[model samples]
Structures are given as structure tokens and as C-alpha cells.
Target chain A: MEEVKAKMPRYYLAWAKDDAIRKKGANGGFVTATLVSALETDFIDVALVVKKKSVYEGIPVLTNDPEEIKECSGSLHCVPLNLTKYVVEYAAKKRIGLPTKPCDARGIIEQAKRRQVSLENVYMVGLNCGATLHPLRMREIAAYYGLDPDSVVREEIKEGKIFLVSDEEGKEKEKWMKIDELEEKGYGRRDACKSCVTKIPTMADLACGNWGSNDEKKTFVEVLTDKGETLFKNAVDSGYVAIEEAPGKGIETRQRIDAGMQKRAASWKEKMDALKALSRSERFEFYVGALKNCIHCGACKEVCPVCACEEDAKCTGLYDERDSYAISMYNLVRIFHLMDSCIHCGQCEDVCPVDIPLTLIQRRFSERMQRHLGYTPGMDVTKKPPLYETELGWSAEAE
Target chain B: MAEEEWEPKILAFCCNWCSYAGADAAGLERRQVPPTIRVIRVMCSGRIDPAFVLMGLLEGADAVLVTGCHIGDCHYVNANYKTRNRYEFLKEFVDELGLEPERLWLSWISASEGSLFAEMVREVTEKIKKIGPSPLRREWKK
Candidate 1:
């Protein structure tokens, strides 16, 4: 485990062997097929999937049936649910499999570190992500372009553009808008996704996406860990999937795309930071102005994926609504607790009733502290968070 | 027409075995201690959670001081090491919250270090005085 294998990363051009699933699933149905196969073979007792309800909405479904897994094919870019808590609360004891975005996988790993869930019983199939759109923003974009939001049939983000296909009178019309252009008008991806640098779920057992695939029907996959290998080997053995060694060009292309996305994310981090231009006193005013509107609703804490403290949360217990400080004890305690483990999932901002730009606020406090500790949270389970360590693991403390 | 001069309220969290005794020692030695400080004593520095510091700030304390036994000298084994670890988080947090970096402090003061305790208090008072009132402070006149 210590030695980084020069060729240890196993790459494959993977596709669902079943014709029906391949047609229904975007790219290949490898994730769906793998989950189905795992369940069929009793490799996992259950699977968690976000069953799409509409183009802009989906509901998380926990099931042990292979048929249900097949129906849950395709990705929902706007379904920003974190599957970690679902696994912890519902499937913590059972061997289970689930597809995950980078942030979801990161949250799960963090939960494992906190002993909230046992990783041995969980199998994560990671997807390479380019940011997800906020559902409310989708409606705004629909209205801006003069289309009925409910009539939209399919939405896909590809080649720096968002494609919304609408069905009217048995005919489909498509409209394309560049993500950058939409974001400039304040109507694209969420602020958290824009600033996020970890686009690939490296912490997951296996990572899969369409970035480097030469064929539109195939997925490029990298098996990251032993559990990932078990899932891959099971699917191939069960004849549920087909795999070929990924071409060198495909691997190079994947790296190139990932690097370009990270570069864009860096600029977005600068552009979207509300605190960047403010003077220290101005920054003070900004926080007070934003956080004071809080009605003491615990929605932000409730939606936080990395937070393991549920009913007995210290933030809620210590909070008194009457304490009329510049910032509330609720906000203060929550921010402090999340300083080390916030994955910047943006769920808190999405759920806030007062619409506090909490994505930016939490990021402002956490980014500096994480960098100073030279520690990145949610990447590995064996390494404890620096906040919990007795002495920080700094290379040159004197320096 | 002068209202009472606004004095900085500094909240100091002292560990019972060490820094609290150090404060008592300061009194016994007749060292000049600042009246601005209000000390809250805990059993050990390890018991001081990051929430406590944030709570102090939210309550309108101009500054909060985290005082503990020196690194290797925890009354409970290896607890002050935990305190030092958490101090790193509080330092960054106070700075990022747009508070002056001088608003939060961590110093290791043993029971014997009466003079150092007195000096740290004086230094904190002067720094807070320059920074003026905490923005969180409520003013009924306003």
C-alpha cells in the first residue's frame, strides 16, 4: 500500500453488455450494471440510487432488487443528494453498493473516518464529475430562453455547453447555451461546484466517466482500490459488462480534460469569492448582514453531508436564538465544527430559507485553515483530520 | 458629558491545574493584573472545545485568551498537546472571521509563571484597546 504502483492504476473502456441498459444509460450503463450484478450475485445486500422524477428532480431510492437497479439507469446532474447519510442511517450494517459523485464519495470517506459508517460494508462506484446545475437555476434558464420548464425532456452538459431538449407536439427541439455565458448572467452551476477542484472521485474504489472515451457508448474507468477491483471483477465474471484495455490516447485525453476543468475551477474560486474584494471591516459587515437574516432554522446543519452529529449536535444544543451577536452561536458553532471536514457540497446554501450565500461563507473560513494545516479532508480514511490529531503533522514546524 | 470609558472585556479560559493556579499565584505575588480579564476555569485545556472560543466572541468579548499548561506538562497525560492542536484552528478561525488577529491568544503559563501571566494580560489589553470595541457588541444608545 505504501508504494505507488507505477502501473497500478488499471484502466478500461467499459460498457454494459446488456443492449437495453446501454441504450437507456448515458454513456454506458456500467454503474447500473455493476450494481445490478452485485445484487444478483449477493455481493451487496442493497443499492442506493436517485430515481429520476423529472428532468430537474430525482428522489433517492434504496433497493435490493436488480430490476429496480436497471430502471435507475442514467445520471441526474441536478440531483445533489449525498448518499453517505443514507448509507449510514439505513445500510450501515449491510454490504451495499452505490454510485457517487466526487463530493458524495468524499463525504462517505469522511464519515468513515468519524466512525459513522463502516467502509468494509460499503462499495462506492465513483463517477468523474464536471459541476452539477442547481434545479432553481434550470427554471430561470428555461424562462430566460422562452421554454416551458416542465416540458423539458432531457438536459445534458457537454463540451462546455448545456443542452436542454424540449418536447412539443411530438417533436423535440433543442437549445444550447454555453455554461460560461449562463454563469455570467448568474444562472448556471452552483457556486460550490464552480469553485470545486476535486472533479474526480479518487477516494472512491473505482472512478468512471466519459471524458476520454473515443466512442459515445463507452465509459473510461480506473479501478482505484481493492474493493473497486472486486466490483469490476464481479461484473465482468457475471457477463453483465464488457471491458477492453483503455488506449494510451484515451488516458492522455482524460488527464488533459481534468486539468482544464481544474484551471477553470481556480478562476471561478476567485470570481465567486464574495469576501475577496472586501476590506477586513467590510468583510465583517458582509458576514453580519448575511447571517443575521437566519431565522434559527437548522436546515443548513440538517443538510450538511459531512456532519455526523444528528440529534445531539453540539451546534444546536449550544445555540440560543436570543444571543444577538453579530453572528449567531448556531452559525458560529456550525462553521467551527465544519472547518476541517467541509467538502463544499453547497447543500447548505441550497436549503437556507434566508438565502445566505453560505457556500461562500463556509468556504471563506475553511479554505484558509485547511491550507495552513497542509491537510485535505475527505481524501483518505486512514489519515485522521488534523483537527482531531494531538499534534499536527507538519513537515517543518520550525521553518 | 463623558460616559464611562469603554474597556475591552477579555475572556480568558484557564486550565484548573495550571493557568488558574498561575492566576492565583499572580495575585499572591501582588503582580499587577489587568481588570479587563474575566477568567473561566476548566479542569484541563483539553476540555476547551473550539465552540467555547467562538461562543466568547459571539458574546461580545473583545478578545479571548486560551491559557494552558506547557506542551509536555499537562496534568492529564497529553491533554495540553490537544489544546495546542486546537489552538491552531482557533487562530485561523479568528483571523478569517475578519477579527483582528490580536483578538485571540494562546499562551502556556505554568503555576509558577506569575509574572508571565500578568504580562500577557497587559499585552492583550493594549492590543484590544487599539482595535476598539468588537463589532458584535450591542449598544442600547444606537
Candidate 2:
């Protein structure tokens, strides 16, 4: 145990000291406690937390008050908002601490690379995620389970089962269903979450979750960087949290879980790619057919996490409504620009008004290009995107 | 009109420092170059943005050529290398978009290589003719 604690990147089982917070939080209250402690100590100027309006809704709230942070405890699995743009627009200059999922952390990292946000001012507490359900889908799921969607007050996922609790006429009822069985019936996670392989937020400062912890009231925490160590020390010294070294068996279990999730995600990706069977001309027809429905709303660009260009973007600037080409210049330029840097977050598809399946189209174009260049965006701050590289740094023969 | 009599309209972007002067030399030498190509001269090959090429294809050009100085011979001290780097991205994009690979061409020509300029135009014209008109072309209503 001492040897494990002595390592640079340490692992531990941690929980909150306060019983109220522990009871309210989904996994222990370690994340909530740490953020509260950081704010109380003035370590961060503000903390960005997801405030749950209900089981189906969460809004990003930026605050310095520790009381508000405590109130925002617990997890909301149906909220799929990416908080990168909010950080850039609202708290880019402040010392901000926030709990991040893998996609949110990756988006922030990519923004840092583009000079949109300073990495030094941001502290991330990462959460391990298997998947998130769309809010509408969750409602449909409630209906399918023979419960009034509005009556459902609580939801929990554990042991490969989805548990829903409903209140009616001063009585409580509970029901559970297997996630695999639900997904097979065409109703589980969002399309993006089903294929995403990054189940753990390894790119963030500290990663916290319940994957490896033996107790339901404790969180398995991994201090991934120097900043993570600082956050952990502050939480422990402030007396808001308690910790114990993670058992070796717990570490093995965590690794096994991550590997299993990644394997399942890869298989899902293969199954979801419908364009793989099409010929060149048919693929062209499919793209034109899908993209023609775009109303030029630009919602996808607004929600895109990797795109740093705010106004006066080339895609919109060069596109003219009069052209009426087979494929609009807007879609063409946007796809071309993101070839090297797209993180495939699926935020675009979520916001697209026409339901054009932008996620599948962007993935088809960008994934092959990224693989050819041997580049993965948002992974590192120093490795510049290959698209911006000069010929001297990037050889033409590399193709 | 017969298929053999159909002429493909080609758009060629020539850099002022090298390829543009090479085209001038071809005219001076009275070389038998194809009249199918329409020349658009820019200050440097690096100035030719990928957007320009994409716009050309969307505008119904049967083929587009990107002509620049040879490697290490760029008049702007490696700007043409940037053009080469961008060309790779354009190549992959065009191919994936279901366009024939033959529709796009990239070549290096010096000011003295007038014969090379004429030969490239003839070869490009021949290939475009064989492939027929691009599907992106907009036919005017009678």
C-alpha cells in the first residue's frame, strides 16, 4: 500500500466526510467535496457544475459558492451537454474547476491547443462514463416500462441494469431492465455513446468513478497528473474527504472493465457504419441526399466542440445560396476543414435541425483521413494538427 | 455532337514565378498545346487555396491542374512546399468524394521547361476526354 501511494500517478478509494453529500451523490461525494474544498480555499476562482433541473435536464452553472456546489451533487446520465464552449465563452480567464466526462475533457484539450483557453487556469475532475442516454429516449424508455414518464423521480444504472423509481399517489414503485436487452430492442444509449471507445477520461487532471471501488459509497480515484495531486491534497487537507489506497485487485478490475467497454464500442462502430457497403457513386448520392436537407441553420457548427472559429468562418463565408450545387459548399468546406481535427463528439448531429446524420458523414470523411495521417486530435497540446504543418515538418511521401 | 468531337474544359492554376512563365515560353516556341485549358495566374502556387480547386470542380470544370515550381526551387522560399502539402489533402478529399483521381493534377515546371508545359496540357486533355464530362457540371436549359 505504501509503495502504491509513493508512485507518481496514485490510485485510491475516496469518499466525502459529510453524510448528506455522500447520500446525495451518485458514487461517493468525493468529486463534490473536492470542488467545494477548492472553491473554499480559493484554489479556483469558480467551479462549473451541472445543475439538474430534473432527471432529463441539466444546465451548466458557474459559481464560486460552495453551498451551490454541494446542491449540484449527484450524476445526471441523460444530460449530454459538452461544456467546452461554455468554458471558453464564460470562464476562460478565471481559475475554473469542473467535473468532466471524456468528450468534455477532450474538447477542452483541443480548445487549449487552439489557444481558446489556457490549460494553466483550468482544473478538470474527470468522470468515467460507459454511455449517456438521450433525454427523449429516456422518456420513451419510461413509457415502454409501463410507467408515466413524469412520475419517474429517480433513475440508477448498475450491474448491467437500468433502475427507475416512480412515485404515484403517495406510493413508490421500482422497476429494472437489462441494458443489453434494451439496446437490442433499439432503445438504449445515444448513437455517439454506443460507438465511443474512450470510457475513461484519462486526458483530464484527475479521473474519478465507481468502477473499481468495492463500496457503493466510495469512488475509485486516480491522480493522473501534478495538478490532480494538488487537487487531491487540498481535498484531504481541508478535511472534506477521506481516502484509502486502492487494492491491487481493484486496479485489475478497473483495467478489465475499460478493455471490455472498448472492445464492445469497436464492434458497435463496425455495425453502425452503413456506408461501408456502398460503391463510390452510391456513397456520393447518399451524401448529397442527406446534406440537401440542410436549411443553413449552422446549428452543427455552433455546437461543434473542436471548431474554434467563432464568426466569419470560411465554410459559411464562401458558401452562396444561389450556387445550388449538387452538394452545397457549406457542407463541403466544413467536412474538408475538420478532416484533420474532428474529435467525432456527435454534438453536431444532436443539434442539426434536419436530422441529416452529420455524425456518420463526418466520421466517414474524417476517420479515414485521420488514420492516414496517423493523427488523433485533442490527445496532446504540443502535437500540432497535421493540416497546419509545413512541408518541411510533414513530408509528402508520408501519404 | 459526336463524343469524339466533345471538348473538355480544363482549369489550370499557374504560378507567376515559374509555371506561368513556362506557359508564356510555350506560346513563344509555338508549341502545340491543347486549347481546352483556361489559365488562371496567381502570384505564387501557395496562394492557390484548396477552396479554389473545390469551387472549380463544383462549377463544372471537367479537370483542374495545379502547376508550381519544383521542390527547393520555390521563388518564395518554400511556399510551394505548402502547396504540395495542401495538395495531398485535396487529393484524398477528391478521391473520397467519388471524383475520379484523374480529374486533379499537380506538377512542377521551371521557366525553361516550355515543352513540359505543352506536354502536360495535352496529356491532361486526353485523360479528361476519355473520362467524359464531370457529373458535377450544370447543363443549361434550352
Candidate 3:
């Protein structure tokens, strides 16, 4: 126990001490308990959590009440909202705690690098994620399973299968389908989630999930940073959570799961990219054709996690409605600006009103530039974006 | 009338400290510079945002030349280095957008290099002439 405490990043199996929280949360409510404990102890001024509205929806809630944090415990697999912007806009100055998926954690880190949020004041309790389904896709899936989409009370993903529970006249019915089988039918996870390789949120303060825990009542938690250790210790000392050292076997199993998910994601990325076969001119036409439908509503820019420029952004400021160019300057400038910094979160695609395939367009442009520069955005905060770097610091060979 | 001989419209961004002076020097000397180029002089090359280049391309400039002071010669001290960095980004952007590599050119011209400035304009004109016309150009009906 002393040796485990001595290490900076320690692994443990933890559960909520409160029976209600233990029963309410997935994987023993370790995250909920920690946030509650932190809020009660004044360690953090606010807790940001996703309040589940339904099996298909969740809304981000920022509260200082410990009970509110307890009420917002469980996971929602279908609601793919990113909480980074909320944290920046609402809780940037306050000491805040929130549950984060890999993309959320990465986005927050990128925002912090851009000086939109202060990292010292934010504590991220990261959840391990395989992928998230679009809410519309979930409804389609529910109908495909012959269940009423509105009647579905609970949804869960476990062991490569998605389980949906529905209640009719107080009688419960359950159905499940394998994720791979459903994906073959062109409906499973969002394109961004399917291609994302960050299965574990190592960039966050702490990473907690159920992949390593054999027991369904406990969470496998890895203390990744000093802030994570403080949060864990506070929860334990305050009698909100109970912890036990994780076994070596559990750790190995978690690593295996992460590796498997990453391998699948890489293959999915290659398979989903339809532009690979097109010649340069064809690719150009494809980009112009896809982006021409943009109404310039600015929804994509509003939800873009990596974009911190807000109202004064050059993309919108310089764009002219009068220019009848093949592609609008708005899109061209945005693509150029995000070439180094795009996290490929697909939020832009999700919010696009014209049904533009921004995920593919952004991925095609930014991914190659990122690969060429050998810089991955949102992974490290100390490394400034390459676009902002000087020639002496970053010299690319002229072609 | 038969279609007039196609001439490329090349837009050049010259810096005030060195490249703009070099353009003036090219006129002072007897060296003949191509009539195909139109120059926009800025305080410094670093001020040339990549967006401006994109705008020039979309506005039907067959080629955009970014001419600046050589490295370590910027009056603002290391500002031209930023131009070099941004030029790299512009290079990748133009290529990915299906523009020919010759459509974008970056060169450093000192205030005294009148012959070099004239030579660059001649070379850029020849390249743009070879490429014909930019696809971004929109033809208006008479």
C-alpha cells in the first residue's frame, strides 16, 4: 500500500462508499463520489456533470451542490457532447471537476494551451471510451431492434454488444446487438469516434473505467497526475470512496482492451476515407462540391473544440458574401487555420446545417498536414501549435 | 476578333524594407521587368496573412509571388522568418487545394538586387504562361 502511494501514477479498484451512489453509477460511482467529496470539501468550487435527460440525451450541468453531482452519475453512450467549451466559458476561473472522455480531455488541454482555460484550476476525471453513437443513429438502432425508441429506459454497451432495456406496462424487455454486426450495416458509432485512437484519456488528471475490473461493482482507476492523486486521496480520506490496489492481471487486461480498440479505430479510419482513390483535381472538386452547400451559419465554428478564436476569428471576419468563388473564403481560411490544430472530433460535422461531410473534409486536409509536421494537437499543452511557431524553431523542407 | 494572346495576371506582395525597394531599383536600372506582374507593397512580409494569398488565388490571380527580405535582414528583426514559416503552410494549402506548385512563389530580394528582382518576375511570368490560366478564375459574359 505504501509503495502504491509512493508512485505518481497508481492503479486501484475503487467503489463509492455511499450505497445510493454505488447503485446509481456505472462501475461503482467512483467519479461521482470523488467529485462530491471535492465539492463538499471546497477543494473545487464547481462540478460539471452530464445530467441524463433520456437514454438518447444528456445535458451538461454545472453545480456546486454535492447532491447534484450524485444525481448526475451514470454514463450516456449515445450523447456525444464535448464539455471543453463549457468548462472554458463557465468555469475557467473556478476550481472545477468534470468527467471527461478522451476527446473532451484532449480538447480541454488544447484550450488550455490556447489560454482559453487554466489547467491548474481544472480537474479531469476521464472515462475510457470505445466509441459513442449519434443520438439519431441510436433511435434508428432502437427501431431496427423492434423496440420503441421513446420507451427505451436504459442503454448499455458491454463486451462488444449494445444492450437496450425497455419497459412496457411495468414489464421489462431487453435486447442486444453486436457492435461489429451493426457497424457492418452502416450504423454503430459516429465517424469521428470510430476513427479516434485515444481509447484511454491519458492526458486527463485521472482515467477511470470498467475494462480492468472483473467485479461489476468496482471501477478500475489509474491515478495519472498529481491532481488525480489529490482527488483520490481526498475521496478516500473523506469517506466517500473505498479503494484497493489493482491486481497485475487487471492492468494487463486494460492494456489489452486499449490496444484492441486502437487497432480497430485505425482500420476504421482507413476504410471510411473515400477520397483516397481520387486524383488531385477530383479531390479538389470533391472538397468544393461538399463545402459549397455551407450556409455560413457558423454552427461548425461555434462547436469546434480546437477553435478558440470566438467572434474575432479571421475565418468569419474576412469572409465576404459577395465573392462567388468555387469555395467560400470562410471555409478556406478555417481549413487553413485548423491544418495544424484540428483534433478531428467531428463536432463540426455534427452541427453543420447543410449536411456537409466536414469530418472527411477536415480529416483529409488536417491529417496530412499534421502527419507532415509530426505534431498531434491536444496531446501536450507545452508544445505551441506549429502554425504559430517561427521558422527557426520549425523549418520544413521546401518541395 | 480572334482570341487575344492569353497573358497571366500575377499578383506580387513585396515588403517595404527590401523587396519593394528592389522593385523600385529594377525600374531605376535599364533591366526590363515583365508587364504581367501587379505588386502590392506591405510594411513587412510577415504581415502577409495566408488568407490574403488564398483571396488572391480565388480572385483569379494566375500566380501569387511573395517577395521579402532575406532571413536575418528584416527591419523588425526575425519577422521575415515568420513569412517563411507561413509560406510553408501556404505551400501545403495550395497543393492540397489542387493548385499547381508554380502558382505560388517565395523569394528574397535585397534593395540592391535589381537584376534578381527582374529575373524573378521574368521566370514567374514564363511559368504562369506555361500553366495557362488558374481554375479559380470566373469568366464574366460581355
Of the candidates shown, which would achieve the greatest lDDT relative to the real structure? 3
The local lDDT score (0 to 100) that residue A343 gets in candidate 1 is 88
Quality of candidate 3 docking, DockQ: 0.61
TM-score of chain A of each: 0.96, 0.96, 0.97
DockQ of each: 0.60, 0.52, 0.61
lDDT of every predicted structure (CA atoms):
0.88, 0.89, 0.91
Ranking by lDDT: 3, 2, 1
State residue A167's C-alpha deviation in candidate 2, in Å.
Answer: 2.8
Candidate 3 per-residue C-alpha lDDT over B1-142 given as tens digits, one digit per residue, 9 for 90 to 100: 8998898999999999999999999999988999999999999999999999999999999999998898889989988888888888888888888878899999999999999999999998998899788888887989
lDDT for position A96 in model 2: 98
Measured with C-alpha atoms, the lDDT of residue A394 in candidate 1 is 52
Error of 3 at A107 (Å): 1.1
Off by over 4 Å in 1: A1-9, A394-399, B1-3
Clashes of each: 0, 0, 0
Best by DockQ: 3
DockQ of 2: 0.52
**How does model 2 score by TM-score?**
0.95
Query: Model 3: how far is A144 from its true place, Å?
Result: 1.6
